[model samples]
Target: MSAPETIAVAMSGGVDSSAVAALLREQGHTLVGLTLQLWNQRRLAGHEGMPESVQGRCCSIDDVYDARRVAEHLGIPYYLVNQEERFENEVVKPFVSEYLAGRTPIPCTLCNNHLKFDALLITARQIGADRIATGHYARNHYDEARGRWILSRPADRSKDQTYFLFGLTQDQLAHTLFPLGEMTKPVVRQMAADAGLALAKKPDSQEICFIPGGDYSAFLAAYLEDVGEEQPDLSGELVSTAGEVLGKHAGIHTVTVGQRKGLGLTSPNPLYVLQIHPESHAVTVGSEAELMGTELYADRLNWISIAELTEPIRVEAKIRHRHEPAWATLSPAGEGLAHVVFDEPQRAITPGQSAIFFQGDEVVGGGWIVNRNS
Candidate 1:
């Protein structure tokens, strides 16, 4: 028999990733545990409303220690790779920019696309490992008929992470493995316990790794202060759907589409943010019914199951991580762009979020949502 493969596992110090390390070790593969130190939780602590102390988040010092302990327990070589500069440039900077442009951004997807898969893959290869495994609940395989790598949803739908992984290229899929794809969260926790991992019952990290308290406004202020940058004055008018000015706002960066609260408006009927215009810095508010839309445009496309999108195709599109896949007609609008029209009006097709296309369990491709007016 050939010798076992030397696989580098991305251990995030969570139950899922630690369980992955244990499983691979049990299977007799040479494992190198790698934890990317993407953020310093204390960098902006106690600044601009940020909490002085934070815990239970990814990339924190505690997570690195936990990951190191797991590697030691599994008797595998572990390395904490520092990629803070790259993370800041690729994920944090873009996150702040997107918000400043009057759009909401998903930093987790940015991290997965730029750091976890892309940067970590390069680091893995530099260390003599041919393949890297992650705790993402997504499955991928090579399709002999289509001659392309296929990424699909995992067995545990609730834990599915394919939405964030839509940007993974075929090359990345070929060199990566998702061992927890077929296992549920409960089963993974059990496996960690069986392997004598101390963090078997550790809670999953929910908020953005760099942001504490899940407060985007505060994080933006704190990040700007930390970097010695002034917050841009994006303050503008809040207009009604028919072009009537309702009121003035502090800044567009503080609001998002589909938000109903903190508008500082007191009307007999409730109002919601229908759209945000970055050029004019105008936030448009209207009734909740106005939030529904049938069409959206997405750019920065990445195709997986198929080589490229040439013709209009029927797909179940997911506009957000928590959104159920809705029936939509996806068509190539221009080079590296797609136009989607859902059969039913989906609520709040926000710019800067991803629109991931799917045919059943398989991820067809995905792109970043763009404002229709843009």
Candidate 2:
């Protein structure tokens, strides 16, 4: 008889991941529960406008305790690897910088790209595990005819996490497993209960693990203070679409494209933030109609299901996570860049967000949005 393959399960101390560990254990696979201590929840606590304490969020002390208990209950070896330095350098710093530069960034995607898959996979291999399984709702398979690995949407569409996972490379896809891809959230919770796991009813973490209260502006102020760096003065003029200076503003970092509230201007016709110019710190305000855009350019491209984009392809492009897939024509603009023109004008094509291309259920490729053309 063949020996069982050793698998390392990335346990986030949540029901989905805990259930994954249980499912793999029942199949007789040698399981090792692993959790990456990516951030210290108390690092910024007590700072002005920051929370006094945080619990039940990702990387909190409570999560670590829960993960350890689950490993003990499952009778498997477990390890909590500290990767705080890497997480801050790769995810947190860039997140702050992106926001300061008049862009909105998704740190979860950065964490998955740099830490969870890259660093954790290295740790898994060092421990003699052949593959690392995560609770992410996505799927991947090797296509024999194409001689490449393909990532696709999961069976549970509502729980699909392929948007943040678009940066996954072919090699990473080959070495990783998504055990919860075929299961819905309700079914996974039931599996956790059946396995006797205690956290079956635990609520999912919603906010960015590092940012408490979902207040980016407050976090930015606290983080800058912590680093002993003075906040850059980004205050300038608020202008209209016709280059008419309306009033003085505080800073560029406090606003984003398509922001309607907090402009501090009382206009009878209602105004929205149309653009943010970081160089001159000029914020342009206009009507809601000005926020619509037709074309966008994305760089830092990563291709999946194909080696590289050699020609223009018709695909559905999602500008943001909650955005519906829109019909678009994607073409190679330059080296490591893609140009997308939506059939219908899309609103708020924010920079620093990801643009994931899809053809049916398959992930064609994705990249970072640098700018958009009206």
C-alpha RMSD of each candidate structure in angstroms = 1.5, 1.5
lDDT values, one for every candidate: 0.91, 0.90
- TM-scores of the candidates are 0.98, 0.97
In model 1, the worst 10-residue window by lDDT is: 365-374
Cα error, residue 189 of model 1, in Å, equals 0.5
- lDDT score for candidate 1 against the true structure: 0.91
Off by over 4 Å in 1: 1-3
Tell me the tens digit of each residue's lDDT in model 1 across 76-194: 99998989999999999999999999999899998887777987799999999989999999999999999999999999999999999999989999999899999999999999999
